[model samples]
Target: ASSRDGYSWTEKQGLKSGVPCIGTIQPPTNLDRASTEVFDVIVVGAGYCGLTAARDLTTSGILVADNPGSRLGLRTLLIEARDRIGGRSWSSDIDGYSFELGGTWIFWGQANVWREILRYQMQDELVSSYDFSKGLNKYILVNTERAQHFTHEEEDEMMESGLRKLVNVDGEYGKRVIPFPHTAAFTAEALRYDKMSVADRLSEIKDSLTPNELSGVEAFVLLCSGGTLETTSFFEFLHWWALSDYSYQGCIDYLVKYKFRGGQSSFAIRFFREALASGNLSYAFNSPVAEIDDTKDFVTVSTRDGKQYRAKRVISAIPLQVMNNVVFNPPLPSGKRTAASIGHVNQCVKVHAEVRNKDLRSYTGIARPENGLFYAFGDGTTPAGNTHIVAFGGQNGHFDPEDNIGTTARKLQGLVPMDIERLVFHNWSKDEFAKGAWFFSQPGLLSNHLGDMRARHGKVIFGSSDWALGWRSFIDGAIEEGTRAALTARTDLAPSQLKGKL
Candidate 1:
């Protein structure tokens, strides 16, 4: 479809101008030169955060009145590595049943995501599901030993008490620590706890907990951290508790239980479609950014294949872990490099398993040490006697993520003792663009590097759930972070004078 040149790039495939190829790119084969497209601002990553940032920045008069010297008539482009736009928020189907392999829940308590739902009148699209903790059977580990079934009421009390002790480090409900969860107000107090890992707290409160209780609590930490909890900061949980309005039950409720009527990916599509229809936005897939260079005036983003895009400013809405993959021309700041070196902890793999049952009880919160997966729960059932369940495993590089069904089914069986008929999943840990699951801050990150991570890097602004204020790991966090990054990128944010550039 090249009218100017007449013939297409027959040397390769899908050589449409401005339309990125929605496939893989092999090295030293096709593209030899980097394409430099100019824009006022170029948003990277097409996930929820990237999409939301693009949408808000495109809205006329939204940031114009607030930003004094900012350009009102701005041209922007969104770049994504994959063909799809949803990023981690993927909604797949098995035997015609809905299964969310990524970020799956949203509620009114998350004011950021709630506002979007209200703005788009998507309340009608909301659907509720059964709680995983209230499941019929229970399989918990006590000192890594599997235990018998316990009633929900009994488990709740033990967990609530244990959780209270975990956050009430000073027995003051974080009054002397993390008093303000929204900003750097509690930086000093937060740092005191930041030096301690989740395991450190578990050891301190070990006396109050039984062996079984301790194991359950440790597993919970693993699930929350997305893998090992030994090195994760204790303050991350406190931040989550504060975000959940100081209620442990609320934290559990928001993480699971609620869902979208249609798939969230569909919602993302609607958002992306609207963005395409409204803004001067153009995008390309199969284009993985490999390098970012910000000079005194303009910024250039380069893909792995040597394609480059130039812009006045760039918003990196990609995952925090993936930052290490991209070569920063001026090497990132030491603080960012330190945090990035440690990286996000949650490399959990979320899988959807189907069992041969017409009616299976939909529940979650099942963990067994032998089983590689950290959690499992029933999602939905099909008329064809297929019961869909979603499962998660935080530890990465432990097994083959490419194995289709049998391997994962066997792993889930060890945890829930279910007879899985078929299994389907997407391993976020294995994803090249997203090296890990949602952000689970490591010890000292919240105190030492979160501010540095969010601080604009010259012409680049960071926008991701990885460093969000409230819902750090949820879709709400991604959207809010993306929107804020875009809106702020247009303004003179009085960004701290970066002492040294990487």
Candidate 2:
């Protein structure tokens, strides 16, 4: 079902000819079993959170051996449902060009987690875009004849206005509107937008916007949220706004400076290779975890294959929605269980196309009434001496890759000269490993479940971008959660100061 190294099919002549490649042999059946008997930590999921957790825990002065030492060397296990290492972050070669299929782009201002990527020396491979201040040309397709260009100042004003509204409501800036679940300033800020959809919010400002301005704003909402205002939560929009400094200007500035030069997948691959080299990490691929038993002192994890792994501590980095399917022996608390049942954002499908054109350098955001394809922009350089463009369609509706590829291309064709060669699309809905791109707080759901959903269950800790308070859907959030969870685990395992019995 997955394409490797591009192209639809490749010949496997070696198997038929009975010729063996060097160092190629049958994988051991006991591969899932660690070379050692037990591990200090068993991390389920090999995504950013899981990998970073394993790496940090292992390298710390902790001694991980038959007998625990002064600083426990962390023995970690990472399990992935897919054949590849990256959970949602993935990249592959298509038409001789590197294309990111999942999450891409990192903002420079994302201090804590993103700084790790730079400290680890990954920035060179991940390129930043052209200057955002120069005001990259933007075009909007308001039906056929309505296509118009937006000036940089116009775009900046629109973004600033949106952010200003998000943070300020009823003459209050950065105030908490909701107080039931938790009393916090951001919560109030989040509550102001909670009742309205992105579309509904925009309608209030329609009178102030020109025809082109309205269309551009509509497109920006759809593209950024990955769904129409009708489907996207106002709180979620505010959350993103907060993550990007409460301004569209800040968001674009971060986007232009923060991105994977070689693509996010490169970081994933490097992490995987590094984990393997550590010789302390073992993994089970294509194996979906079915159950987790935390009744005993040690946590036991059972995969669909019926194989079990027992460890002192467990980390569930899987998306909240998927976690509901895995049975927990003691049964998760009502709140945590309810949070999982609430599920993630709607299904998302991303399309990448390589066209015969180089002049198309700027990113394009289009908002169409009939079809709001979230966001589409020129992504990378193609092998065919052209530009690679990508589109993100969120849960609002579905678009057939084959049927709509022509239409999407034509829309872009009007803006820039290009001959579409081939198209690549990934339906995350159809993907068993990931049911959706990212998690979203539905109306009335965050108030009811955000806290309990993040609470730890016994020795098991849950960490993912979805559970993060800030930058919920970004890699920075994932790393922040990973670091936080690791610290929690480390603290819990520390020896009690008052060991003697009274």
Best by TM-score: 1
Error of 1 at 498 (Å): 27
lDDT of 2 by residue, 230-292 (tens): 767767665665555655776676543455656666676665566566766666766678998
Clashes of each: 4, 16
lDDT value, candidate 2, whole model: 0.62
Question: Can you tell me which runs of candidate 1 are displaced by over 4 Å?
Answer: 1-37, 62-73, 131-147, 383-385, 492-502
Regions of candidate 2 where Cα sits further than 4 Å from its true position = 1-36, 63-68, 130-138, 151-154, 157-189, 255-257, 372-374, 400-417, 496-502
TM-score of each: 0.84, 0.83
lDDT of each: 0.68, 0.62
